[model samples]
Target: MSPIEAPTIEPVSPERLAEASVWIAKLHGDARGRAIEEGLRRWLQAHPENARAFELATEVWDDSEQLRSVVPFRPLRHVEHRPRWGAMATALACMLALVIVGVFWLQNVGVVATAVGEQRQLVLEDGTRVFLNTDTRIVVKYDKEARRVELRRGEALFNVAKRHDWPFIVTAGDRQVKALGTSFVVRKDVERLAVTLVEGSVLVSPVLPTLPEQIQPTIDAPGSIEQTPVTTALEARKGAGEFKLAAGQRLTFDAGAVTKLDTPSIEKTTAWRRGQVILDDTPLQAAVIEMNRYNEAKLIVADPDAAALPINGLFQAGDSAHFANAVAQAYGLVVIERGNEIVLSGKPIQ
Candidate 1:
């Protein structure tokens, strides 16, 4: 048998649609506190049309940037008070025309990604800017309550816009970073997760699991092997405590049970934005890993000695040859080219 489908929801009448737009404007405006919320609840409960109209208006608000310009010129009235019906009809007609002509309902949710050695910049409908590093993938979804972004892989810097009523959150693996109006970077590697706050505060916490009833149970035969979920040491050590990170602070979570939290230099943390990598006493193996993130060519430290050598200074990203030459001249090592791999080996002792 085929799966069941959800019932389709329809929008409310034209007059209610106009009133809903006014309510949305009021919600986003300076109006606040219990009085505003109470008024909204009463309006929504008055009729099914009022509720449906409000829901449609929210979707329009999420997708239509033009809707912002249509907000009332005069100070918004309280929810308890109603605007003139003739003016409301005029507004509704204008919104319908704009929706038919411009708004397509695509920008409210989508995926943004970048390839290796490629960088990208995107501005969301809410005016928040996202800067993606090499080999990054992020999913952006905006709703009435919040603006959410899932950092599926690689790293990205979020310069969030201020929306006090609407929160902004980024989720990576089991962890999430919540912000209001701030700048921060979240990087997800194969075995590690790093969050660095650049200019604003963010709350770093574990993502809560879904409700019990929503989870499906799995049954196995008598001789079958039970599948176990993989839990990293970092997650095991990261208890239920939520961390509030201030600007310039960095949190590193890896396979190790220890979670390191420290204040790192903002310049070094964000140097990738400039297509440069700055290494300060970083091991050859570690530096190689960082450089390979931006280039198709791979760098291999041929021996343990070569891999342990310390590297420093700034170098252009994706320039593996330049980095290899610098290392060879400085440490008297041998650089051998093998296909796409640049092998660095120690000079043979006499």
Candidate 2:
């Protein structure tokens, strides 16, 4: 009988090994979720070398005392309970800045915030540059082992610095993004989280908590309907597992746990970075929602007919009056100013 040949093990490249290292760290971090599990499964199955690389990385990560001792940052349990701002009228811009800086200094963490109609830029201690959009907030925590940021609310763009041993992670709600060094935009809205990769790859995974499966009514034997196990919006998202976004790709995770992946228009995605709101056949109502994020005056669409009208153009951010007037003129609607609110309705009968 021929002697059994030794198994051929494909060699893992340095890039694959680095990716494995990041994955190992994330697996041990607070960002572990069903999505991460599935992502790891896929990555391991993609190639034989991937499994070897992951095993090798795991061995190193386990043996390194520094890696094991790195404590993950826990989000603040206390949320600031304050009256919601109808506009940017809560406080003066300068006053808000002072208050934010005080909080940062006292907490020993970098807290960057932007009120309505305001934007700011900052360079973190790790050389990461962040561009905060209007009405945004982010808390940065950097330790000897890792760099992390908690996006409490709003949107921001991150230009992460390269640190192979120290991974950069951003956590928003129940989802998180992991990167070594890359440029990406992260937006946390009321019920959604969106991430757009600009120049490098990033891992987008949900945090803990596997959303429960939903139940649906299905017809049984006769005419009676019975409850059946069904996948929810979030379950579908969980099924997609963790997302590995490429440059120019976008991912949106809704509060309901639904996920959408697309290669959007980079120009449109980064328009806000240039202080412009670019709309491409957007509905009047949706346009108002986007415009309101950066303006002091609230825009309300009072008429359903007018709200359904399509708007297409590039407009300045925070210029609610200009956006309202342009939409009204194009759709022949009426724009009425009521104190700080701009109401758009159907034109009155002549």
Q: What is the per-residue lDDT of model 1 for residues 131-155, given as tens digits with 9 covering 90 to 100?
A: 7889999898777767889999999
Q: Give the TM-score of candidate 2.
A: 0.61
> Model 2: per-residue lDDT, tens digit, 1-350?
22212222233456776677667655665556899889999999998788876765554443232211111111112233543332222122223323222211111156778899877655565657687888999988776556789999998889898887878999998788999999999999998889999987787765646454343212234322222333466445534345677789888878666567778898888777667788887877898999999978899999776766767777778888877876666666788999999998885221
The candidate scoring highest on TM-score is 1
Top candidate (lDDT): 1
Q: Tell me the spans in candidate 2 whose CA falls farther than 4 Å from its real position.
A: 1-108, 209-240, 347-350
